[model samples]
Target: MLKFVKGHMESIEGIATYPMISLLIFFVFFALLFWWVFTASKRYVREMSELPLDENNQ
Candidate 1:
């Protein structure tokens, strides 16, 4: 059973590399997406979090 599965996997070109590449790509994409989303809504995020900018925050 294991050998059957292994033989199938070995037959596929770059199947092993696909996961590593996709994982790295996903992380990179997610990181960039989060950065963009955060920067785009930074003011809103801060306001929602109630983080006062001044000492006597309004």
Candidate 2:
């Protein structure tokens, strides 16, 4: 296990810093997506509520 870890660590040493930065970019993209979906869902629900007629109002 130690040998494997050392080997993998050595191989990844050059890219070790990049993975963290990439993860940050990934999270930022996902966060933007989540925010968009959240606001869009709110708009959708609001629009549906404003319909002229519905099962309850009838």
Best by lDDT: 1
Write one digit per residue (lDDT tens) for candidate 2, span 5-53.
Answer: 8888888747678889999999999999998877777778777877766
> CA RMSD for every model?
6.2, 6.1
lDDT per model, in order? 0.84, 0.83
How would you encode candidate 1's per-residue C-alpha lDDT over 1-58 as one tens digit per residue?
9999999999998788889998999999999999888687767877757765555675
State, as a TM-score between 0 and 1, how close model 1 is to the true structure: 0.50
lDDT of 2 at 13: 47
TM-score of each: 0.50, 0.44
Please give the range of 10 consecutive residues that has the lowest summed lDDT in model 1.
49-58
lDDT measured at residue 8 in model 1 versus the true structure, 0 to 100: 97
